[model samples]
Target chain A: MTEGSSVPQRCWQIDSSRKGAEIIRITDADGKSLIRVKPGVSAVIISSASFLEVILEEGARLELLRPFLLDQTLEREVSLSVHQAKDSSLTAFMVTKGSISFKDNVSVVLAGEGAEVSLNGLHDLSNACEAHSLTLIDHVAPSTKSDQLYKSVVRDRGHSFFHGKIMVRREAQLTNAYQLNKNLILSPEGRVDTKPQLEIFADDVKCSHGAAIGQLDDDQLFYFQTRGIGREEAARMLVKGFVKDVLLKINDPLLRAEAGGML
Target chain B: MLNIKDLYASVEGNQILKGLNLSVKAGQVHAIMGPNGSGKSTLSKVITGHPQYVADSGLVDFEINGQMVNILGMEPDQRAREGIFLAFQYPVELPGVPTSEFLRASYNSVCRHHGLEQMDPIDFDGFIREKMKVLEMDDKYIDRAVNVDFSGGEKKRNEILQMAVLNPRLAVLDETDSGLDVDSMKIVAHGVNLLRSKRNAMIVITHYQRLLNYIKPDIVHVLYQGRIIKTGGPELALKVEDQGYDWLIKS
Candidate 1:
């Protein structure tokens, strides 16, 4: 159960020595959650909410899996903020499916030295739904690192948006950050919009960002046809292939299987 | 096993093949030599029923079940199931789809078309490995993405590998020699030569007579301005190699 004012709030304090995953459901009209991973501890959090605050103390590690597969029509805006201290690491995975109109905005701050963060996300949208995912990562300390990859498969009239910005401060020398967004539009009616921005004030940093969006390659399809695979089956294999690499990043075998089964 | 008559085809508003005609019986090897933009590749695409290459007025009849049936209306995959293949000049690179998986699916599709049970993975792996050994391709290629990051010669060899795996009856090798080195070309030619038999026909499209030296076509045809200008024995290829296509195109 969550403590609430007008909007329900679910709060959890993952104290030191915590070593397990916790699944929390945000079922209210609009919900917020506060997750704090104490120093030197590791934990996994799976949750759904409109507003989420995640804090990782020194030497803490966190893995977050966010699954949004609700069939209900969700026309809502969600925002997530994450703060990491020295020697902390955060790896987050998100899977969004359904004909729900939802917008997600996430910002991460590597506030202390030697922090690292990685985000892998995918959105499989159908119908006339509209989805948006915006990520802003800031490396504020020296020797910090960040990586982000987001992909989308939009079918029918669904439209997907992915906007990511990576900012490395002047003091964040020796930083390494990269971002890539790939999109697959299945039908002529489907659409994808991507914007990747990198602002670096540090000279001794490795940073790169890219975005690519398109339908399946016609020549690739024809190549399959030349080998006796019909157009429909060829398209299926390619679409399946498009989303597989993201799923492969999952280290937990059971979670990987479950995510694959979702597909 | 394949017949083309009065074929007029175009792609992207350009009429590339105009009134082209050819005929090949089973066990025959036909070498098509032409310069760039002469529609040698267009003919292969037309035979394979490429969607973009429209047949304005022509007939591409393919032998299936001992009958010559018009295949222009059939889809490319249908034409393939009935035994037509094109070894593209530039093979398409498919990322994320491993070579083994794609080949297995392709092989199984052909099997299903002919009413056969699916080949088990173990058997299929062994079968394809044997073919790979002949092409001199490494074991690492199968587990990687098809044609992705492969060297130019390696990509051409991959095409031949597929040809060996699918075993198409009428294979159009479209400049299969362009990217291959001499030694690699010999290996590919050897692999291709082994696949030639009475049950299959081949159309080798090339710009150089060097490839024809190994594949050894029975007939050599000069394709200029979309149509076959001259058809001769294998000696014609040597003559064309000695003298450029200018004399033939002028005649």
Candidate 2:
């Protein structure tokens, strides 16, 4: 279904009931989208797909919260793109969990001067699942800023890949961009491949990226155990703390609580 | 009360505690002094059930609620919940878990083991604040990550603070004064002294006699080659401090 060109004041939610291959275009200058995937729907047979596009005109503001619950084996894909105009701002929070094979592609372009973008994502994978998330952020105009943080927890034989690319064009001077990807592997068989790429053609721009993948620290675990916390409880505490900073990026209290419960 | 007889322990195929024996009674502080590689640290680990250590033979017994409990087969956490606390020589740093949350969880876990009610967050904060005051610690430490980016002295003080919070029946401090400065050492000693009571016991393991000056021990034992070679009063630590362990090892 297509949302008209008028600005939207109310939140919009898209679910599996919409069926295969849906596109949502947000052309309004100050429109917002709160897209949440409904729970307990099996995506294996549905093969659902969604595409989201947001365009922010001059001096416009937009916020998006997309939390997906993938409790069963499912194959699904989501594509998101955003274009910001001069003095425009966009903030987005996305969380995905429990997909057998899932793919997400997100692209944001700061095409106008004084534009800003902040994107944060959290993915929780378990039980031989394969998930991939790719994000591309482009700073095309001067005085544009963008920040991205993505964290994932992999358990059992699950595998996850995060590829983030931030490009600062030659004309995008005074551009401030930052990107980080951190993963926690809970089991020996779990695997995570994270690549944080930065392409900066402007000499005066500030850009940085970091990626890390590791298991729980033995010493830290022992510290908790020594405090009379059971092994299971200590592991749970560590995992919760590992993803807490990223999860707090979600401003909605209900959504934050839901995401925390999933972890 | 704690008792160990002919304790033989090893780690990674290396026997660290060979035929070691010791006993500690409630309301008493026992100081174990020895040279490096003399199983001083290993004895503490064996008592606390460190995962890396393997107990080949012998038994570790603790009197809990007037009953002798064999702690040899217990898990590390089980041993802890049974009122056994080990203040590590180097406390591990947890970068994201706040100190207050960790301490409260630990306290509540032990409380739950004894069929007691858990303290609410507000009450726990107050309890921890009072405990920190005993160590002369700042209130800022409660909000920071557990031992993360802490100075050497602060880490030692934090260990004492944890011991105070847990209030274990048997506390084994492993070289707690190793990295502490003079002022920090006194604060730590003061905290330990305040925790002393007739219902609890402490085993202070150290390499020097300097720490003995502050927290005076009732008995001092010289550990050598995985065994206690000499047992004496507080004067034994001073003897080791004056002449070092060379003469003891040669004997």
Candidate 3:
């Protein structure tokens, strides 16, 4: 290693708690990187947008928390790709807070037997912020499983877009894949567009996908009001509850509680 | 604690309650029994200040802090803070609002209304578990989403549980015994009976007299075409049970 070099370090380290906690920031100089998870290791990586190619070794587990939360007005596109080996698992939580525009594309390929992956995302937008997501999961081997849920809460003039696709190959017998996308539009001006696609070539594979976009239930609002909650507070509770389950996937309790208050 | 006089209400240009008049004292139980489309449920909505149910004219007043204030002029939550509760016949299912959190919010809202200290989640956990004993309910109900996937009986018990927790001045049980089995009815009636006190009043609205067999009322009123037609003792329910509302509507 050259001390005067401008190249960033690529060393991977594990923490003493056996659960790796890291913050990987994406900068202009480091526009791309390759991540190889060691076998039988578990780690949690918190990162922002960059070109990330992750390969999970056999029996390895990884939790990725990618949050595109910005204070300044900006627009950007992010791409993430992952490949899984035998008996490996990965869960990713991608959150997009209000912004000018955030275009996120995520792809995963389960190439070995008994591999599993669960991916969840939440996008809360207001003040004309725009969010777009395209996710694809491919089951390439037998006995692979994938589950995904993505949700968005839009208010004011904000708009959200989601397109999710899953593919099961002919050799991927006994494969299971499920995908769901739900969006809540809180105002008349707010809008949501969602689409789910599933392609299966294996007869023994189980695959399902669904998408729903709507507003909060009026009956629920009245129920809360009858219990002495004001209309504004009731709406807040409903909005928070709409995204609570998706946020609960964050493995960190403190961060989960903090996220509950935000979009 | 409640006074209703010549109250006329409508929904979507359809008049449901036409000049309905009834008076509830602070320490009395009133049972309003009537046939379908007789404004029994509309009257309940009028008191709770439901937005769709418009009160075209007349007065619905409750004694709030020793002043006879017309509650129809207040917001729904304001009326609720003034000690009015309605146990919904079909409790709305809240998918992500935990029962414990909902109960605490309700209890603390009432406390904040009356200038009392609000209990945090930890203390509220113990406070609510103690109240759950009155309904003979399993403690797991506190962990679930409110009324989501709960059976009819469980939902009723949960309503009664809320009533027990809030301890409101006026409680209107609208057809609470419609879908309950005998055993479940007894449990619900037991919970409701336990909450009965002189400081608070109850208005039990039911189609059948079976619920009255457990939580007996002091006065029974037969509502027909949005007005109380007959007011009698407990035997009034028995007579309605035996003869139905045909003779009452005629006379």
Candidate 4:
């Protein structure tokens, strides 16, 4: 059995601590890979049950499968700032389905000529649970870009917010960026707010943003019903389709299947 | 076989179909002709289970496979599964859902209700290709969104294409030829004529006799004041075209 297939348990747990915690660097030395989340590294963090600061160098990749659950009072911080030298790529997936408090944040800074980064995450809040995720991507070089697509489904007074800012410096010309945030209010009183900002000081760039909030399609419901799909099954299919679009993009098939089972 | 008895329906608190009655049998075509505000379109809507129209009191029964079935209590989707298809006057433009996907979903839905295995993509492609060839429609319309960005003639042809694909037991077309040119009108009628069979019935609703000139309905009913005021054979449509509804209104 692999680490992903170990448990179906739930609890409130914390990560371990680190020594000399000023700025720790995990590098993919000559022909090696960066962005390490192996058992050795994660065990150190999970065992410590505390906060730490980490920095990532160029050509590094990481995969976050389980929740980075931090206790509510600790207010832990994890910052990842990457610089792609030339023709490098970075991808990450954050999957959280439970109530996790403690002010978790991800601060990303990109600096390279032809670097691309895709940050995608999905949080499912149901049965009076609360989860918050804050993501920031900064562009510090020209001809570099980033894309963000995030979705949330909240039920029974659950809350979700995604505030993303794409900062194109005055000298960062010929940059391309896009951000999309969509939410489905499963209950009448549940709420969600999405804000996408483009602060550009350069004129030779293309940027776009959008936000949509609505209920399910009534005609689609009737269409399914006429075909003998029960109301609850139809609703489940729509909701699952909405989230599967993001989770299934992960390159690791094991992680993708795990997410599928969760749904 | 289908029957409508003393149907009354309204929309937004205004009555549209008042005490309408009609009956259609297998291996037959009935053409419904009327001027504007004569409740011709409303009759079709109420029969097809459109939610906008509220049925005050009416009964629509269909004898499917020699069994009488009441469709008044069924939803539109249920009505569709039970083999009642409405070729809309205005086909909806579904933006993201591809035509092939929509067709397969609709086809499989009805198939599943009848206890049949769903057709895979490979089989469906061949099936739709043959049907499209019969209609002389471009192959591109098969993969594109349903009626999205289609020309007026193209939309009407698409309605006929769906009729051929679903092959419903009964088809009711509402003003399908209002916007077509002469060539498109012929193509539309040809497509409909090809699909007419003894096991399936049809009701062609239009204001002019031009479409009837192509498909040739077996009977024509003149609708005025939300009711069928007159019924005649195929010659009646030609008479209405020669002497418009103005004379019929006076009589």
Query: Which candidate has the highest lDDT of all?
Result: 1
Worst 10 residues of 2 chain A by lDDT: A40-49
The reply for model 2, stretches above 4 Å from the true place, is A1-49, A250-258
Query: Against the true structure, whose TM-score is highest?
Result: 3
Residue A40 CA error for candidate 4 (Å)? 27
State the weakest 10-residue window (summed lDDT) of model 1 chain A. A1-10
Q: Model 3, range A1-263, lDDT digits (tens) per residue? A: 11463442343433344545443343332365556778877776666636666778888888777777745666778877888999999988888787577788999999999999999999988888888899999899999999999999898999999999999999999999999999999899998988888889999988888999888787787788788888888887777788888887778664565455457
lDDT of 2 by residue, A1-263 (tens): 13574443444443457542333433332234423333322111111225566666676655465566676555767767777788877777767788477788989889999989888888888888888899999999999999898888899998989999999999999999999989999999999998888899999988888999989987677778778998888888888788888877755565567567766
Give lDDT tens digits, candidate 1, residues A35-58. Answer: 888898887666666688788999
Off by over 4 Å in 4: A1-87, A91-106, A120-133, A152-159, A184-190, A220-263, B64-67, B138-155, B178-181
Q: What is the lDDT of residue B229 in candidate 4?
A: 87
Q: Rate the local accuracy (lDDT) of all candidates.
A: 0.88, 0.83, 0.86, 0.69
Backbone clash count, each prediction separately: 0, 0, 0, 9
Better of 1 and 2 by lDDT: 1
* Candidate 3 chain B lowest-lDDT run of ten: B73-82
lDDT of 1 by residue, B1-251 (tens): 89899999999989999999899989999999989999999999999988899999989999999999999999899989988989989999888888999999999999999998888889999999999999999999999999999999999999999999889899999999997889999999999999999999999999999999899999999999999999999999999999989999777
Candidate 2 contains a number of clashing pairs equal to 0
- Interface DockQ of each model: 0.71, 0.68, 0.73, 0.22
Q: Scoring only chain A, what TM-score does candidate 4 earn?
A: 0.72
Instruction: Specify the CAPRI tier of model 3.
Output: medium
Which docking category, incorrect, acceptable, medium or high, applies to candidate 2?
medium
Using TM-score, rank the candidates from best to worst.
3, 1, 2, 4
Question: Candidate 1's error at B150, in angstroms?
Answer: 0.4
